[model samples]
Target: MKSTLLSLLRTGEGEFVSGEKISDQLGCSRTAVWKHIDALRKEGYTVEAAPKKGYRLAGEPDTLSVHQLKSRLPEPSFVKDILHYPSIHSTQETAHLLASEQAEEGTIVLADEQTKGKGRLGRQWHSPPETGIWMSLILRPDIEVRSAPQLTLLTAVAVVRGIKESLGLDPEIKWPNDILFNGRKAAGILTEMQAEPDRVHAIIVGLGLNVNQDYFPDELADIATSLRLEKGEKVSRTDVLEAILKEWDWLYRMFLKEGFSSVKPLWEAHALTMGKEITARTPRETLKGVAVGIDDAGVLLLRTKDGKLHHIYSADIEV
Candidate 1:
């Protein structure tokens, strides 16, 4: 009810809203309406109240509140709560803290901006407030530890599908965790897990999608892009976020039921590196070969010139 009233107040171009109109629209008493307005005030909203005018929402902080995300969630997810911060060191770090405290699966931690966002191979991801979606999901999956790498691939599929469905644009997965649009990077996912060698514990899937950024940092000008830059229009971060959660939930359920063997074909078709000649650099050395599809264990298969197959666990690839 409070969120509804605030949304209504935002639509009005006046300095104040009549208390009677707010109470009538929300089907609450005037006192109750005032209480809601006070709560919004406490949450960093500047709402002014007057006898002639009901309540005027003058300002709102850029926090990802439960009421805000709940109104945006797709019908499929039961997003119990959202832990939001105006700025955080990292969503993954906060997610680890929540998981240690036994936060429920599907509980999301989102930040308007991340001070220390991460990517695969310990690279830093560029995240700015109101410019990208920087979020982490705390998940507890019933799967073997060895099967974990598959989750990264699975999430890539979800991100790609989400962007396509929500923005009506085609995006492809670049190997393990990169989402590419028009040969440039649009999004990246970082999956960090805490578990025993053989058992599973918690998986914090962190994703950062460049949504409305028009300019990239000089260092990232060659490789990064936002949906707005690519599509020539600003995209709704909330809509894309909901689509990603919905797609991930569906794919995750299927993965738990049948494992990676079932999703291998789809991943292969969506993979941008498949059947292309590429250079993959691992920690020890670099290899150039034809990029074949991944095996059941999610290891990259590189077909060498000597007609031999080499398995790569993690690497930065160039096509």
Candidate 2:
């Protein structure tokens, strides 16, 4: 009922929607309409009501519904389209389909709740309702297929920078792309690419950020932490999302102008894995070494105890 009422209110686009019309459209009594309106106000919605003018949606709170998001971000930085869902199987799955259908570059898919959220290594990312930012971006950069991995690193730098500036809290990046605070996971990025031989097609970048969760499930309670838990107060998902998108637009423009070298140092500055001794587990074998740095190709440089430097393309790092 709130969804339907919200839709009707948005149809007005700041104009007043009469109580009689809303009741007729929703097939509810005038009193029921008033109750729903009051409920929305209690949830921090700004609704203006008058004797004869009926109700006007002044503004929405920090919810991530498409209407609120579109209204809050009146001018998009670089995003082409924003497709929002109340609940989805996976933003990445829907983005893959959209990209295949030639959706414009910078199309974003966002969900309030993901029933089957995905993580690295085929793990499930727990995304509770109204607690996090779950979104996927479709990017069609004109670069070689080998260079797509750098986009992940670039995104990492943007997330850490956005969080620091917006929330005034310190956060670090765990390569290839994980946002960490106080040695616990706060956010993760998954980058998937579709390419043709010797050319590139589209890259789908998925970001899951735990913002205001009060508690996690038993299994994730120890391994996962939300921005609220880390900061000891509630955090706004909309604010964080807006900051990240803006920073991403700026960094992405830099990458397109100067290439990955421009983003390389920025990523290194936020990386928590740099100059640390860790064990890296790849598909082939496991190696223990001190993390030196990343190459221009975005591969990890690990110096083993034998003074040998090896490029690690993919691995699970245990620090």
Candidate 3:
């Protein structure tokens, strides 16, 4: 009921609704409806209550509420709980802390804005509120520590597939964890886990997708493009987020039941730089090579000019 009210309030233009009408429609008393409206007003909603016209939704604050998100989700059952923040340092950071306390799987921590979001190799992920989708999913996968890296590749495929299905945009995946549209970055994935040498622990996958941002900074103008920019229309963040979770659940189940053999072929087929010439850079050294298919371990298989195939565990790659 709260989510419905919020959604209707955000419809941008609506006439004032009378208390009797709301009470009859919602099966509640007029006083009860007034209480609900008051609660919303306290939460930064500007609701106008006139003598005859009971209540009018004037303004709604920018907040990612669980009620609103779940209302938009096709399958909200898969999402156990949603922790929404108006502003946070990072959703991944909060999720990790929650995991330490044995938070349930499918627990999602989403932030409208991440002040200090991180990408691979501790790189700063540029997350501006209402410009992109910045969120994290906590999963307690039944897999060994060695198999955790494969989750990143699996998530990459899921994200690309979801984008294609939802927006009709043919996005491509860069090896490991990047979704590129029109040769520019559209989304990124960061996978973190807590495990011993052999056993497994919880894995928190952080996703940052450029959704509605129309323009990029001069430095990233040529390398970063959002879904809205590419499609020339604003995309609903809620719709995209729901699609990603649904697709991720599918891929994740496959990986658990069938292993990497199931998703490897699909990922390779959608790889953007698989057959292209590229340079893979590691902290130790950089290797120039032609991109080949990824191994079962989700390592990037780079065949250098010297005819030696190197499995890159972690690093930045340039195509």
* Model 3 error, position 14 (Å): 12
After superposing candidate 2 on the true structure, give the runs of residues whose Cα lies further than 4 Å from its correct spot. Answer: 1-38, 41-62, 65-76
Per-residue lDDT of 247-313 in model 2, one digit per residue for the tens? 8998998999999989999999988999999899999999999999998888999999999999999
Query: What is residue 311's positional error in candidate 3, in angstroms?
Result: 1.2
| Residues 1-319 of candidate 1: C-alpha lDDT, one tens digit per residue | 7669878898776567788878888999888887888888887788877667667777665444457558776666745567878799999999999998999888889988998888887888888887888989888888888778888898888888888888888888888888898679999888888899887788888989999899998998888899999889767777787787777878887888899887788778789999999999999889999998899988999998999899998899988
TM-score for each model: 0.80, 0.82, 0.80
lDDT of 2 at 11: 90
What TM-score would candidate 1 get against the native?
0.80
Candidate 2 root-mean-square deviation in Å? 6.4
Candidate 3, residue 303: CA error in Å? 1.1
Between which residue pairs do clashes occur in model 3? none
Off by over 4 Å in 3: 1-65, 71-78
**Tens digits of per-residue lDDT for model 3, 92-170:** 9999999889999989999889999898886888898877889998988889888888888898988888888888888
Candidate 1 segments whose C-alpha is farther than 4 A from its true place: 1-65, 72-79
Candidate RMSDs in Å, in order, are: 5.5, 6.4, 5.1
Worst 10 residues of 2 by lDDT: 67-76
